[model samples]
Target: MAKLVLTRLGGTLKGRALTPNPLPRILWRSLSTEGESQDPSIDPFLHSAPEGLAFGRLTGIGRNTLKTDVIHYLEGCKLSINDVKFDYNRAYTPVGVLLQFPSRSSFDLAVRQTIRKGRLYKLEKIDRSEWDLKTSYDGKAVLLQGVPRNALQEDVERFLSGCNFDPSSFQTFVRPGFPDPIRVAIIQFPTQVDAMNAFCVKNRSFCLNNPISMRVLQ
Candidate 1:
């Protein structure tokens, strides 16, 4: 009869044949568990925000803070925040949060807005706190060149309908030396998302007698 060798039975093949090593099952399992623990996915590497993405920080965050509270606060302020990626704890325990925004304009607006203290979410300020804006913007206004000098404000607004742009926000600028009758019109939108959507009208026919080109300034 074969003798029990740790977790399995071991028998000699013939006379003087050596038995298999008698390693304990617990030890074997421990080695396998250690291998699994070394998986790269569970690594504790500290990652920073990637390039081209706007980043911001919110302090005084608690473990009890819910994602819903953050969403509600953002929507309440009409912030066109979209596709925001979050990292709760860059450390062991929950300290605060880091936010990454795909939309630079949205990030600019959000960091400038005041977030009032609510039931669950708390901040250092008793009344309110502004999200720390860590990025800069060259500009967000749309510039339309070669606009017909004769086009009225009402005519421009009609062509820019559904773009959420304020009718009174369009301004015309003309170079003093250049004698070209064409004028440049700069239009501003309420939110960054609106500015993004403003590009959808690029192909739409703006004038019948004049040539015009539009571009969103960085």
Candidate 2:
């Protein structure tokens, strides 16, 4: 009976030998318990904005352009300006100005009047959804194809900065089951206007390589 018991114990040890580095069951249980303890209602990166505010992009406007000039231009238009921001690219070149208006209808009317009056700057309304980095519902993200496999995240970020936009996050992806692995990058911007400007100014080469093509995610 002792010999039979020893044989059974030896068999169990041999089976365990197949998995030499087995993890403790308690550790796995702890990990699972921690995962289950997390609350689903909380998100760390969500951004919220006030309701009734409208956003618009203005081109052909310089950073040094006097604010008083703009105010005088819009005087008697019945529209109120909440805020004005000037955005610049990595090259220190001015991209344009972003304006916040009190009402969407007033913003649209202002754009039309600017176009009809042949103002120095052109205006276009941008949806608020474009500012939400989480959803990226309005193609606030861009994808670059044919990126060199050896390229690093810093290289991509630097190149994008030169184009006048900063990336919130940069990620590289490889397709599975392909004979030769093809790598691409998905870059998310803080705002949709940046992504749109990058897309509009296409056909530019970066990394001292081929002229890469960029696609805006819809």
Candidate 3:
């Protein structure tokens, strides 16, 4: 039988029957003098979820630390759990755990993130002869990296207006803060160097180590 034990610290000990299967339940507890603060080792609860497990939570220093510990623990257990967390804020570097999830889940998460995150705009793919821009010039869509606070849609529009391509055809993405959403923008440039330059200058916040390919409709 599933047992649901609902407890709000200092409030009530409400108990509801729950399934025997191991799903999850919320255990709210008042900040007791003894458990006032979580120990770094036991923090972020996800680590305690059992080996070869998966979950999510609010992001913070403690959460991050917990993640590290969880990874180490998993390694010790000879287990690999798929980790997934939303980056609505876009502030957290989408590395480590971000790269750990299943590939399909990662792609779906990214698409959903693009929808709820923020306003999307188009930017030009500037090309310098140094990098490969052939694909971008072929009218294929490309991804640009940027941060929300720093991205100027107008500036991007104006810069791309003079280029051979239509500025309105592409989209711009700046990493937003917590609860915002994760997104990647698409654009077409004459060469890879231009695409790279724009990405570096605009999407500096993402710390994106590699560029993603875009499929241009036009």
Candidate 4:
């Protein structure tokens, strides 16, 4: 397992009151229990607004930061990550397939919004602690872990229906045999077993002869 050594959360200043960046909101996923999924209704990551926060509520500064891809920027840092694993799984959510989008920023924005919507099953945040950073695989992958959410297939399909991109333009499958729309994909897994089950399902529409390769932080 990757060691989480950093304990202090950073903050930003809005005039005089110190406040946390949303990245810390993302990090709350890391602080939650391992492997055990939680109720979406109770997730702190989704409920971050202080008591009475509303969607689309943002200070000008926060708005700018809201659009910021904090996770994307952090992915480039030469840090340690430990106990990393990777496996190819069927495309389950828009983010799973969207990760392959040519524009990284757009992909990041979509993911943040989806998580904020409060319905999908989420996993731990990418291990961003110094120890997790130091142990991460170099050049193999920038995004280390993902959590699957229970996205409404209809909701996702409706979102994609409006997109200019061809539904077929993205990767489709024969191994897992996904239909016109795939209902799920691997986001992040807490263990290799879970990741593998997600990736190498024997009866699923898609099938991987070999498990998708995963890497560990050295």
| Candidate 1 vs 3: which has more TM-score | 1
Q: 1-218 in candidate 3: lDDT tens per residue?
A: 66678877778677777667666788987656774665666666865654332222222223223333434533322224234222223333322222132333433443354344452311111222212211212213344443233445564454444434346656665555356644545566665455545544544332223333322211
Off by over 4 Å in 2: 1-136, 176-179, 202-204
Q: What is the C-alpha lDDT of each candidate?
A: 0.51, 0.60, 0.39, 0.29
Per-residue C-alpha lDDT of model 4 across residues 130-199, encoded as one tens digit per residue: 2232322122211111111233334333323322222221222223333433223213334544433433
Q: Which candidate leads in lDDT?
A: 2
Model 1, span 1-218: residue lDDT tens: 34443332366343333467776766333535653545455555623434244555555555544344455555633323332223322121235444545455655555555343342333222111222432211124566666677788777777777778777777887633255544777788777567767765563456545656665543
Clash count for candidate 1 is 0
Better of 1 and 3 by lDDT: 1
Error of 4 at 118 (Å): 51
lDDT of 1 at 185: 78
If candidate 2 were superposed on the true structure by all CA atoms, what would the RMSD be? 25.1
State the lDDT of candidate 2 residue by residue for 1-218, as single tens digits: 11222225745633222324655677333535554665544644332433377877777865445344555665554543335544444322347656667776767777877877787778887775543322312346676766677888887776676465545577787643256655667777667777878767653566547455676654
Q: What is the lDDT of residue 124 in candidate 4?
A: 27
Best-to-worst lDDT order: 2, 1, 3, 4
Window of ten residues with lowest summed lDDT in model 2: 130-139
Q: Work out the TM-score per prediction.
A: 0.34, 0.34, 0.22, 0.16
